[model samples]
Target: MRFCILGLVEVQDERSGLRVLPTGAKQRALLAALVVKAGHEISARRLIDELWGGHPPANAANALQIHVARLRRLLSGPAERDADQPERRPWIETTGHGYALRLSPAETDAARFQHLTDQGRRALLHDPGQAGELLGQALSLWRGPALQGSVLGDICADEATRLDEHRLAALEMRYDAYLRTGRHGEITGELVDLTLQHPTRERFYDLLMVALYRCGRQAEALAVYERARTRMRHELGVEPGPALRELMRRILHHDPALARTPGPRPADPSQPRATPAPADDAALSLGDEMARLHRRIERLQREQDQLLRCFRELTASAAQRDMSVNWEGS
Candidate 1:
């Protein structure tokens, strides 16, 4: 049998590809914990603690034994059992004070994912091209949220959070590889969505601005900075950090620094200056100022229109009242 734990927890038969394990909540939790901590022996007492969180029933040990027995029976097929004691067989091995799921490292998807991620990271440090492919392989192992159909308590919740962060790190590494290969334009949409989902991650915002600038959308890159700056100030009551501010400065000055190295760097303390001819710099600055003024004008125009509408309604009501009074006088 094989265990799938990159997403939902499931146990499948190797030959028939059928899920032989029970789908009960407790059973699924038990399987999830085992998969996350694979190749290690988890004590029954620890299992009970995880399942019940220190409020176990009086017969908790007996209940756990029954559950383990059920899981073993489901995993053990008829071909492996003797006719004399078919119902009392054990598939989970008994250790000194715990039970261990007997499976090879290759039988678990979580294990495979971690292996591929490690290989990918190593490859990234050596060859970015090969690293992208390895990272892609690692990402493909995730079917959805880790342990998606299982009941997650404290331990499982922490494991799930760690797995999610690992996945994000892998994605960032893959995007780095893409940027190294000059595929920034192709990744702009994905980076945009990521920024929307995680608005506070400065690295994603930096990548997005770089992608936009590289794609010859300098104006859009500036807009991205404005948005990120606004979000940071509104949500966190602070301006963009040094790294993001440096990126914005580069964009504003049209500095060659925008296309420098692929890795992250600390913000240079010196102020950036426009490198183009004086006439060109003047034109770019004029255009930027015009855009800013146009935005302010639009906002004022909207407010003026609302005020005019209200005034016209009040004037019509006053006119109607005067006509009624004149009719009554006649």
Candidate 2:
């Protein structure tokens, strides 16, 4: 069985696929708190405090015990049975005054990700190339938002924030690697997405503009700066920082300094730019074509409206003539 905490909390038994925890919110909270603090024993009192936020009920301890029992049963259920032991087993083990999930540090994706990132950072001083690969590997562990569908209290919220910071650092480290290797074009789209997602992150915007300029898309690079400037003015009532302003100046002056510096001698010959996925390229192109089609449809509807108006006028005139002739005969 493996517990994944890099994103949402999930437990998977190789034999039985994925296991869904019982439905109670507090019950799930109890499990998530333990999972985040995995490998360490959490005191029963602390668990109660976390669940109830200090003003726990008189029966809070009893309630916690009940929740723990339920979680233990779920973990030890038939789905998690091991061949070595015919008896069902509980993954959570009890300490003198606390409980710990019986999981090796390696069994959790979150732990492994953090470990790899730490190693990468240390390796960076000696071998940036190897550090970049390790950081990239660490980043691939995240599937989505951490603890999705789970409500986080004060402590869990802090843990989530710390985890996110680590992920971002790993991403920046990877970007640095790409930059070092002169893979400027490859980082452009990613930097664009990152800047959009984290609009206030000035560094992302700077990196994006640099990447764009390096790829010889000077016009597009200037446009990106303009967009970032507009966004900052409107959203935050501020201007771009010194670093971004300097980048813009360099770009406008066509500074040779803006060009990608060749890496240490014996640089690999530049490879052809990889084609973007067909689905993504098609979606972008289809968006423009769809807009044109909509405009054409609107124009046709207007022409149809004019034809209908003229037909109505002709029908009224003919009806009036018939009525006038009938009146004259009478």
**Candidate 2 error regions (>4 Å):** 14-22, 54-58, 78-90, 119-132, 233-239, 268-330
- Over 56-97, each residue of candidate 2 has an lDDT whose tens digit, in order, gives 889987888888998888777643466665442567778899
- Model 1: per-residue Cα lDDT over 13-128, one tens digit each: 65666765567877877777766666689898988877777688899989888877777776677326335645444547778887777566787876778888888888775577
Cα error of candidate 2 at position 205, Å: 0.9
What TM-score goes with each of the models?
0.71, 0.68
Report lDDT per candidate. 0.75, 0.74
Which ten contiguous residues of candidate 2 have the minimum total lDDT? 273-282
Model 2 C-alpha RMSD to native: 14.2
